[model samples]
Target: MRWWRQLSVVLALLCGCATSPGGKPPPEGNGPPPPVPDTLPWTPCGRTAIPLGPAPEESDRGVPEMVDGERALFFVAEAGATGQGVWASRGTRGPGSCLVRVLSPGPTGLGPSEATRVGNRVFFAAEDPEHGRELWVSDGSAGGTRRVKDLWPGKTGSEPQSLLEYNGLLYFAASDPEHGRELWRSDGTDEGTVLVQDLDPGPEGTSPDRMTRGGDGALYFLAHFQGLSTVLMRSDGGPGAVELARVPSEGGILESLTTAGRRLFFVMGHLHDPEMHLMATEGGAPTLVSMFAQVGGMAALGGQLYFSATTGKAGTDAELWRSDGTEKGTQRVKDLRAGEAGSAPGGLTVMGNRLFFAADDGTHGRELWVSDGTESGTHLVMDLEPGAGSASPAELMVAQGNLFFSAEVTGRGREPWVSNGTAEGTVPLDELAPGALSSDPRRFVRAGEDVFFTAADGTGTRKLWALPLRPQGQCGASASWQALRRDVVTSAR
Candidate 1:
């Protein structure tokens, strides 16, 4: 059966009959009822279809990104398939959608790797046929890919990981023959590559990972300098890197770091006990911003920073928290009280004045959730039906006013889903392709009115997919409503 039909059947079983406001029946509908207003405040809408690519037999595909305002690419790791690599797709929507071949290198074949974009080129790390793992670059325009550096050259280089654009150059961590995992940088030019500084240069020294760009004009990263403790470091593309702060010896570790304005914010401690904290760019004491104890994912928008934090110890519920970089003003933005169970929030993005996130509120496996700083107004916009055991949203990206994400709704697997912020506006963008699971749909760049994302064919092949923002006058009502009818009828059948 067409995946869309399967989706509809699943949703119908989950949502039951569609009735008007106040439980009123449709006014004698025969030849298709009047088109619903696509602009419902917070409805979800969009369609999902199979992306074009050589579907693999089995494996996981993910970590998608839009690049150069045109291409969408992602990594495909075939469970046991050798030479696993990254694939690209051009033009997010319509029949012209297809994959563009790129580079892949493993031990004897290409293994799984992560990719990020800088300017017109895409930078990633993959196992080299000779070296362990090396940094490679692609122009996004299909062609031959080249190894930018062999880091270790002759000996053994475990893996050159964490490719990030900072201070006008691409910086990453790689393990050299002499040094464990040290910091390296490239200008995308034959200044070739330079070792910025080794996090743990000694034999017993640990490696530094998770390199993040801070608003203070320096790079902030997490490393285990001594013992098994993880500490945060700041480097200004200089020789002497400064150790900004260390994780408390209370068995806590910092997980992620992000920058907003002049302050650097990060998630501190393990998942079991988490807290959102902030530090100055010039290096100072780390301040605890929230007492919530369980924070996940943080994004800075406008002048305030938003993140997900658990409100209670129920272990099943969480809420969105916002801060103005102040301890006293930190408060919950969404008033979703803990129910009999709780919700797990994931993937957050900022568009204009709103903050978007993903959550599984016990009922909807995992659907799109949004907030605009109003406690009473926060709610679910898209509810992937079937109340199944599998639906879960991966990443959230905002492009041209619409939000895009990946979810596994059809027991078949996870696929790319889109929404316009309304419950009725949510739809799957890649629900047509059989066995196509789209994960990590991110808006890397916007070209004209279109948004591009990386998606994996659940069949195992990972590739890029693009979709245009609803054009003016194209659909009389809001595109959200049009996307609802189109996506629901088509995918849900």
Candidate 2:
């Protein structure tokens, strides 16, 4: 997905319905039976907080690069006052859990977005007063943070994007002024960091985007050949990137490139075309699974690929779907909202034996829904908001066997919510901000026993926060009926 809830509006427009980005529209018929609220209110997570400075707004871009040597996550975060640089976190809850060492101190930031870890060092792009924003590498410490190479030296940065790690090398696309935009590989050193081959000769580069890794240990990316033509290209550590196939680009389509099993799966179609096809990278000429399915987000679970797609078919439109890489295998999982109301599930995530997503099944509005890969087994997990106004779940990430997402309650705004797929297990981390503002947590990166993330403070400025999660591989299915009967009472209201 490009971001969150863009799929909601896309689905609404395509299916002739009205589903808000933050909430759901009322169904045609009567709503479902009113849910019996449990007694307990919002359960607060007694977690320690660390101030990693100011982000000013919620950016779903704080990436956590794994530093294997220190068993920590090396990331770019804002700290102190207007200082954004490389910082490391070991994922512990106690003192000194957060490490704030500014690698490049600047007013705006070091501009480290996609930092990829190779051998314990993270390679990323950081801003420098002398040299704009260029490629830099860090070893999780101050002394080790430095630029790898100035591809376009002296403030004219080779602004790089899509840091991909494979075969002991880092691959990405950078815009070198003379060479245009081309693929480059690095071995985490200055001498080793050099341009690979130029796909599109000079300044008017191929403009590679959506760089994805396939099952066969090769890179699959999209590049603009002329201008209107979008080509699917491949590079197998070869002499240069080559065009694999030509993809139709009517709406800048098929960016959700994901590797499911041995094949790379993504969407392909224009905006108004209801015949959006779900295709794979391999399997001979790309199989078209659905006639009108625009898959927004996908997750591989239980050896099958599950995604949220807008099928434009009544209740099944914008609901959960799965594929076995075959036309017969690809079908809507369930008509979750009955006949033709549209459940419209998004944020597809898999935990343990079930698939968890945020859906409005006409009855429960927009709450958490879970499935066992069967229509009969797919049902509502809990009603967090309890009415047509939804607690829409997006940015679903799994940490310590539980699912964490951003949800909006009436008074709470949108905050970090934790759920183990149950009524009582679903709750928000209720910590006191400055006032009524939300600690809108996003960009979760799990390292050791902690999840490092960013959240908006009471003053509507973004800052870093951490939650010490349960141990990895621990089953998070902890919701007693007595507990649900208690928490649902006040929490649902």
Candidate 3:
């Protein structure tokens, strides 16, 4: 598939409407606000909803990232039309201001997506008639939106992916005619943009994947040498990248790379024989931490790593496990289910000093659970669905000191909910879908004073929605909303 088409598929999976695949939530919980002037679109709780294009031509499915403190950058695309490209909000809430303004509008659009903010600028990959899909940067304005470097120069792009901000620089994997697909970093300038290293050292580059930053400010990634081996390498952006470990040809797959403190953790080998390995970010050989039949939801908290797994070589039940980068320290936090059945805890997110995830005890089907690195401290936060029914909380994220996620209940199928690590403090926001249906809110991103997300409403059309960070004030009567509406009326006269 073409690069842009591949990206569109990934975006659809990431920002799925209705239900997620396999009837389960993704491993991570991953939004904005506004009131309205008379000319602007509006919603409840000082919120704003903007629909892009007409009907079938929906707004691009992805979370918008903040460029500065006020403006947010997003993309709009139609299946087979033009006049869509990079867009941004007017950067002010209370006024007769247009909610959004186009940064780059064209017949084919810019194909701008996968945005990452470095300092005050957002960097992304955009395609145009001239340059296929190269790196572009924006300061949330049309004048500021421009290409950083033509790496590949002509119509064929460098095809940059895995954009990450490391040590104040934007790092990504791109394919140039000379470098194949190697590691490159940019300081957001043509002169500053340069190749960091050549891993494979030929026309067929290493093609690094699973790029992760260690706690010690080093870049760690997996470089597949095609017919040879998959090398685990790290670079400090100096001379070259250091290979830490390797897996020979089809032995197994290395995946789930993460870090905690100065230790870099990853799982090597394939399913049913996965081995947890840890290497010191400073320098050392890879150490075997533990073994598991099935594992996922690996997260770091308080200098320790936590995940879900089924111990030994064969098991179907997966339970919560934590490791201090050692075999003895790597053990299950609790056997939540008591018998052969496992709690299968996943989406392990850190809020305050606790870890929150979704797990199933025998009593309650699958509900919200929390832990503090201990068996006793690990328990259900609330039975959101009450009885045997599972609330199936997905997308657990911490924004502005609270936990935000999506959960399904009796009256509400699946909707956005927030929590303070307690049952009473946990509650749902305004019903976006209403009735027994769900908007299936996902990809919550906080920008300025609001959180933005894409969700379907009663009309079942997915659009960008913004909600205040606090969401405490009454609907439609917030001070900001009233002021914004008044400004629109005054400006009309």
Expressed as tens digits, the lDDT of each residue in 54-143 for candidate 3 is 211232544433232333323433332344355442112321111122334322454556677676667887776777778988654556
Candidate 3: regions farther than 4 A off:
1-83, 90-110, 249-253, 270-282, 470-493
lDDT of each: 0.56, 0.63, 0.65
The predictions' CA RMSDs to the true structure, in order, are 11.5, 12.6, 10.5
* Native-referenced Cα lDDT, model 1: 0.56
Report the C-alpha lDDT of model 2 over 363-416, residue by residue, as the tens digit: 667888899999999988777777677888877877646677887777777787
Point out the higher-scoring one by lDDT: 2 or 3. Answer: 3
Model 2 alpha-carbon drift over 4 Å, by segment: 1-70, 79-82, 91-94, 97-110, 240-242, 248-252, 270-274, 313-316, 339-341, 434-437, 457-461, 470-493
* Ranking of candidates on TM-score, top first: 3, 2, 1
Model 1, 439-460: lDDT tens per residue? Answer: 5343334432345444444344
Regions of candidate 1 where Cα sits further than 4 Å from its true position: 1-50, 55-88, 92-105, 108-112, 140-144, 199-206, 248-250, 270-283, 311-317, 339-341, 360-367, 382-394, 406-416, 428-430, 433-493
